[model samples]
Target: MHFDLADLRLFIHIAESPSLTQGAKRAFLSPAAASARIKALESQLGSRLLYRDNRGVDLTPAGQRLLQHARLIMRQVEYLKNEFTAYGADAAGHIRIFANTTAVTEFLPEVLAGFLAQRPGVTVDLQERLSRDIVRGVLDGSSDLGIIAGPVNASGLQVLHFSTDRLVLAVPRNHPLSTLKHVKLKDTLRYQHVGLHEGSTLLSFLREQVEHLGETLSLRIQVSSFEAVCRMVETGVGIGVIPESAAKRHSRTMDLTIIELDEEWAIRERSMLVRDLDALPGCVRALIDTLLPASGAEPPSNTPT
Candidate 1:
């Protein structure tokens, strides 16, 4: 038996849509033509693929199996198309990168800028996600590379050292906590806090830590970025927890103080993760090399809190 990509494509469309007519519309084929294609596919396989109903169609057992393989095959086809297109476009390459807020905000700008400058033909698609989600994306082949901070379960991917940063308490210069060089999270929880907005990885981590301590964060204000949080703290709105890199940078120009967090989790080591280093395209590999530190170079230093 012989089947074409069109058959598999039509099968997937039919399986996903509420009706064959709708699927056919999406596939740019007439309803009758789509139905005929499905019938021919079923006949070739000698198995019923879908059960028709008034509302739509449901996949049969054989259809479900085929759906799985079809999705995988489509993914491979897309990859092949992109690879070939890059080759035809004068050695251009594309890389997809997913990173957490800390890595995106505090680390990647300079590194990515240099990488892009050196390799003019390479294009990057960058997305911001939580470290855990970044790990999942890399493992599922949705992302070519991931830069993450905090702890993550990176079991199946190759992990490499990327950078190191620390969480710090940012306060107005005259605030009570500013007098202290380091403080535990619990000690600062008693005061109103300026926080990153909800759904931020740093905010989520802070909330989880507070929950583990059987307490709640007394959030006075929530803002979208570290710069906003620092500004709020500088105006004495409330103390804020932010990366030391950001706090230090802001303190140079603002009346802000950075106090090191006394918890073990405060010192975060960011990591770069990939599904397989060896399988990366030449241009992608070159970009990776640029991101990595030179052999025997000093490890990233934590900002003075």
Candidate 2:
């Protein structure tokens, strides 16, 4: 190889972070070492690759051009490595996955169990983050794959609609809101709400629905995970709005109640995102094939009526 993969990898990190210090931290190299590698790469190409300013680093015309090609070359290298690895062959590799709280808690458990059973040697690192983090993780190379809510837009990643999940309103079993047959969007907003953090897609969707009704949802407390939101609702902190699938897990064991959000603003789609499916590691490929077969998962029975 005329240029080392490490060199291009470092460049991509620098390009994304735009800070030699931050990029070096992420790449696990000293600032001086990272700088020297870029300098050498620029020298070999006989071009100025970066412009440093008070603000941060900016890629020069040459740098931007190389980044595109470097990404392509890296994908090719990854695909080459994947080809030689066997199916279910204890392929040792890293797969960083990001998923929304609902999928992480409700859907991923069974999928992961099956995947690990087939490929025990493979390691799975999973994160429970919101949709934006999942998309950003793929773009930043922090995660290899992400599963999240609909309408996640990212230029650097390949997104697939692997599934659709419904969102519903959850309340304590004895709460007043639990009496509604099917909660309308307007009705749901009338109650004090317990919500996921601002990072969550559910929160954003709730905000949009409330706004469309010419009202604001009164969010009493914002929590990080869907589980926390459910716990809060169970404790009567306030009514919560979460994915129905997520609500189902707690429904069996807790005194919580769920109702369908009225027709106008109900169903939301969830999806799978990959940095580049063609460039996936063998273990990742196997896991994907098992968890998200071409048919995609059917809407789970847990969806609220």
lDDT values for all models: 0.79, 0.76
Candidate of highest lDDT: 1
Q: Residues 28-66, candidate 1: write the lDDT tens digits.
A: 999999999999988989999999988899999999878
Give the winner by TM-score.
1
- lDDT by residue (tens digit), candidate 2, 1-305: 28999999899889889587788889999999998999999999999999987787999999988887776577557656655665433364556789876776667878788767766556678887767777777775567778877676677666666677778888998988778768787876767888877666567767877788799889899987778888899998899888887789878777888998776447767677776665676777677676657326642232111
Positional deviation of 259 in candidate 1, in angstroms? 0.6
Report model 1's TM-score to 2 decimal places: 0.76
The superposed Cα distance between candidate 1 and the true structure at residue 54, in angstroms, equals 9.2
Clashing pairs in 2: none
